[model samples]
Target: MTKHIARVLAAVLLSIWAYGAHAGDVIRSFNADILVREDGVLDVTETIKVNADGTDIQHGIYRDFPQYVTTPDGTRYKVSFEILSVTRNGEDEPWEATDTDLGTKIRIGDQFQLVSTGNHTYQIRYLTDRQIIFGDASDRLRWNVTGDEWSFPILSASAHVILSSGAQPFEPIAFTGSRGRKLADAVATVSGRGATFETTHALDPFEGLTIMVQFPKGAVAPPTTAQLSDWWWRDNLGWVVLIYGFAAVFAYMMFTWLWFGRDPKAGTIVPRWDLPMGISPALMSYIFDGMNRPGFTGDL
Candidate 1:
């Protein structure tokens, strides 16, 4: 059967009311749309929305910059597993496809399973033309997760038909998500009683992103992968080191100018205005010592 039908069955089986169910109960839906476009043409705009009771399979492949979406009750995820090989196809194309063993390192059979009991750091390196597959990785998933890493599809496989369709003003591509959901933000012209709202949102970096999604209620929740943030201002030792480094440089410059500077050591003598007559440090010391003595003083 199709992925959508399988997802629906899974949701039904999982949500069969084993006990009293509440609104917050989580369910998965496999055939949810997950792409969108902004109204403006200048940008590749897309917004993703989340509303679901279960987790499902969502897939997409695009060459332009990636757009992301997460929901209050639902979380969106992308999984990666990529392999490379070389092949040559033609001479007229100016690109060779016949060479085997391209730069891809991931093999088709290699699998990733994270059975972490607590928060753990993971290194993920994937290279694919564009495809996301997340499956069977969570349970032994351990860290309250049951899913495993997914497949890295071939380059020619566009996740959705929209990828190859080029850009259209009204056509927005969707990325399927969990639990009978569909989400995509594309360039759209809404016909209203009078006018339309056409705005564009910019693309974002694919790596190292921070997403804050609040639940229907105001919730301060973190991602499934707990990542901590610490500012440099909070690090006392770092601050101390920075301050000392600056101070050392300043002190060196001051000493250089006062003692061993060009004018002093290079014979570029600086004239001294002694006020014509003045007691030296040595002279002052001698005078001060004599005055302290019990001798008859200066005049008497």
Candidate 2:
């Protein structure tokens, strides 16, 4: 009995030790490079390094980039997310892109494989549109470089926002902490047509890094209607086709009703009490009035 109790206690302690090792995994580095194009497209690349211990980081990491935003005036617009490539540790890694309620989720790593325990680096390249908010005086870009949904603490994070050639940027700012905290925890600097941000302290779990930069008017153009429509159709092809099919059907039915199904104008409604020379009273009632009365054959 004594030996059994000792063994049981030893097993419990071993389980606790194993759990602690995996629970302490952390994100060592997160770096984002964003380029603002003159035609309103943003090319972004992210390099993320994680210290994995085979817990939640089993397969690999998933990055989320939002695809829409609602303005203060209750208008919602689309932001397109087009993935270019993904690599892990200098080699191409298998990945897939999916649309979720949150945004475009790029799931990196093969489902059949498990990531080795230790530090692993992932590089993701993607293109996005409508990330710039064009204003009358300035065009502003507010980007969440490292999203706030990570389950682990970020030891270090940074971002660099670069503009097109010959265009200067201004008012570079960065915020760190939970969403909407506004507490400044990073330093921002402007060099030439680019702005850089680096965190002053390590970010806790659920905390993120957001950067903003402003450009002079006409530096970044607003997306044209053709571009917007193209994205809309690509993202929602099935729904758009279904809606248009229903609309076409309704239009055809309405046209047929107006052209061929409607009755002729009621003969000017001459007021006369006497019946016609050859028409009987019952026949007149059945023809002029509806066929609701008994023995009415006008409908046939």
Candidate 3:
């Protein structure tokens, strides 16, 4: 009876040790790329590097997003999510996804064992609608990273956001928010039309990670015909006024010249040269006699 009790106690202790060892899985790194389009759609691609402790049999991944978001103007937009694809180590992997009240629950385990000594990379791609809200004055996006919601701790995490066509020349403002503690060490950069945010230190569970970006109004709205015409007239009004003023001045000058500014003797011909001041009668007679010779006498 003593030996049996000792054996049972040993087995219970070993099971507890095994369970503790299996719970040691940790995330090495996480990266997310979010693309925002003009049609109010968001395409997200996530890459996660996880290190398993070689004890757990499988791994499960979950992602969540708000079902609806309300803007400052009391406008509400419905949010929807669709999973695109899932891959592990560059190969496609099968996953089971279910919609829950909180968000989405994804399970990848049975067929492909995730228990390994080294690191394994998993890439998840998905699409969401109405993630960006277009307001009358500005467009805004509020995105949350799955790093803080994961089961294990994340060592490093980064997110890159790209605005698709139609949102050019608009400045973007981005900032980060944490759930529990203040993460003052988060770094964010805005270049051209894209923004990038990164965190170097570990992210504890439930310490929410979120990014907010705001774009100026009219960035995604194309100009209507009336708007284009109004802009054209507004921009070229100065040139048009100057041209009409010049035309009026030229017409006035031409009218004056034709009506009251002409020369009085303009139609009459004038002699090219005047005769000599004085000449003797004999010299004048000789000059006239010489001019009245040969070819000069034909007209007479």
Candidate 4:
């Protein structure tokens, strides 16, 4: 029937339009600069250029940072991430950070606002700890420069890792591919106390660039005990709040019962009926109520 054929055509047109909305947005460039401080913290700045189409990218973009890392021995460690600032086109932008199952997601944009279609530049400055591995001979910084799982393709990506002065860095390596792939399609270069990496070709969606740099031992201090405790509390704060709330409620109930709900102390009884002013109820009511009362006047 003609009606049935028309419905099929409408369905096909709708699917095509939906796909086009997402397919038009792309990452023009992604650049990251990492500064390895001597106090075991890494200060990073990422400048991301996005070419968004109005259809799907009306709000803004979100960046995700992975949370946990497991060693060969199966020991898992949580990485600490703190956002310093986020700017769009050289001005402050509204953003929110939340912990997701994948990691930390920094969502930038206002729900009530819409970003115009075209190129927009975003700069994110943040601090992260527990990203370095200390070894006997050297310390290692293996970081995923451009995180995988982006829905849009990236045309170019690069990173620069800077260490302190007088520190020697060697054995620089770079990998480019999807997660868990070792495709060596990138170049890593080491200078005096820094390492730089760049991808050789464009990265499709779900592809990323990971770089590594090894420096002399003791270049950066290991995390202290206090830092470890802080990270632990950060990871388990939900449980801590829950327990604290229950304890507070229980303490309040116990205090209220002790102060107000207990039985009164036993005392000797002294009975007296003086009406306080030495006036009988019948006379008081006859005077105060009405002299024409049925029984109050007679009793008085």
Candidate 5:
């Protein structure tokens, strides 16, 4: 039993040594900034400094989506990633992109030649729409930093996330290690109409740095005064004009009828009385005829 145990221990130590020896590059610093837009788009920028040991000619950086991500409401969404831009040493370098079964691989070098031995800086920008999940009560954003599958050990790592301007205020939560074995604190600040969360630490291979933030529902921007006025005219201006036009026409008809539409005889006053006893029939007839013929042009 003692002989078997010794052999097993030696083998384990050798394997550990071999694994450590194969670590090609070391990360000096890794910083990431994530901006959450109002339209559910997440804009991400990562700055990385790598200390290449001069072993390989070219370096590869890759981004892959998680198989599944669960929201606070137990709903799951398939993650997707899109790389926007990549730069090396503050200058645009030649890179080859390839789509593989695993994910996208971006190799950076000089004319497909080998990379030099030294500290190199790289910046990568990407877009992802699956990070922020909308809910009935609030929207939630889940981010995984170390989970991106880096092959090197990171000496220092930092991340900052800026929420949308219309998002409701809430505290953010962060976790570290496998299965979230440790909880980490983050600094939160409110600037202008949005909020930001920042944290910094170091990470080993396979260790995860994850964050989850909850914001209020309907975090979209409110309508501005100018926008409201434009919308009103665009949607309801015709109705308003039609109503006012109908009112003016009605007023004109009323005025015309009151001024010129009445009957001419309506203003005449006729006197009715009992004739005096001894009045001649001819005289009465003459008086009635004259009254009726006042406006009539005929032989008198």
Candidate 6:
């Protein structure tokens, strides 16, 4: 693989993850090999299995590179493949043409004229669309396995298709999911307290719509957002229970602080003490003044 193809492999792995944007919609099995010629043209051969039982599997290969996504069924579903150049043995040929969608065909004589739909799927050997193309054949190519391809869902149903006999440079993405979760404009309610490990569940080839997860560490298992509290109760009743309990304690404390136990001096005093009001300093002065019972003028 050329450096460009190597980088594109990373892109392809990510797109496989995006194919899982909607779970249960489609399930796919596939294998691909990337080839780079001395001319900077890239070729990819693939064998794909679609999971549409009794459903006709129709697929198209787009020569337009870099901006597309492939469906789970291995259909180049989104984006357009527009070819720019075609060459053979270092010589230019009139075989090259422009297309709004899939570019001119170099091998099949005519574009879309010989496009075939079969019972299962197709295996293209040199299924060329553009400089960047992927095809597969029933004849498996004994290529070297550089490393393990990563996938999710723990147990994944896989289909292995041979790439090319000779191995170029290849970089394998470790620890991939069976599919992936796609990010788009949507509403999501996050109730749990842990991290949600975002991963792609499967592979997509055409749309160039890839599922990429940003991890501080390279391709580790996704972090869980599953909260213990969330598993504890319906409506998060456990959380509610804790809140109510705290409130109850607080209310009790407030009541005690406000009224339950207070200093007698904190309230207004009543005038009905056992001691007569005249004896009290508050009224004694007035009472004595009013009594006018002054001591007999010095017994005069």
Q: Model 6 scores what on Cα lDDT?
A: 0.33
The deviation in Å at residue 71 for candidate 3 is 5.9
Tens-digit lDDT string for candidate 6 (214-296): 11211112113452233234335656899999999999998998896766666676777365744776466556574765533
Judging by TM-score, tell me the better candidate of 5 and 6.
5
How does candidate 3 fare on TM-score?
0.57
Query: Which is the leading candidate under lDDT?
Result: 4
Q: Write the per-residue lDDT of candidate 4 for residues 160-236, one digit (tens) a residue.
A: 99886457678999999999898888999988778889988778889999999898878898879998889788767
Compared with the true structure, the alpha-carbon lDDT of candidate 5 equals 0.66
Q: What is the C-alpha lDDT profile of model 1 across 65-152, one tens digit per residue?
A: 2222233568532222231221111111111112222221222111232122221111121232112111232100001000112211
Tens-place lDDT per residue, model 5, 1-300, is: 999999999999987885575467777777778788776668889888887876542554544445355557995444446778888888876666676554456665555456677788988888865456566778777677646466556666666777656555466666666555664734445455444544455556555567777777766333458755764564466789999999999999999998999667666689898878987776788677867654445786
Q: TM-score for each prediction?
A: 0.18, 0.72, 0.57, 0.71, 0.55, 0.24
lDDT on C-alpha atoms for all candidate structures: 0.25, 0.86, 0.67, 0.87, 0.66, 0.33
For model 2, how big is the CA root-mean-square deviation?
11.9
Question: Per-residue alpha-carbon lDDT of model 3 for 1-300, expressed as tens digits?
Answer: 999999999999988975464356766677889888665568999998887765442554545545555567995444567888988788887788776655566776445544456678889998876566566778877677653456556666778888786453233333333443455545777777777777755665555456667777655554458755764565467789999999999999999998999877766787695557797666666787867754332553
For residue 93, model 1's alpha carbon misses the true position, in angstroms, by 40
> Which regions of candidate 5 are displaced past 4 Å?
1-24, 55-60, 63-77, 97-103, 166-169, 179-201, 220-300
Task: Locate the minimum summed-lDDT window of 10 residues in model 3.
Answer: 168-177
- The window of 10 residues in a row where model 6 has the poorest summed lDDT is 138-147
Candidate 3 Cα errors over 4 Å, as ranges: 1-23, 54-57, 65-77, 111-114, 166-182, 221-300
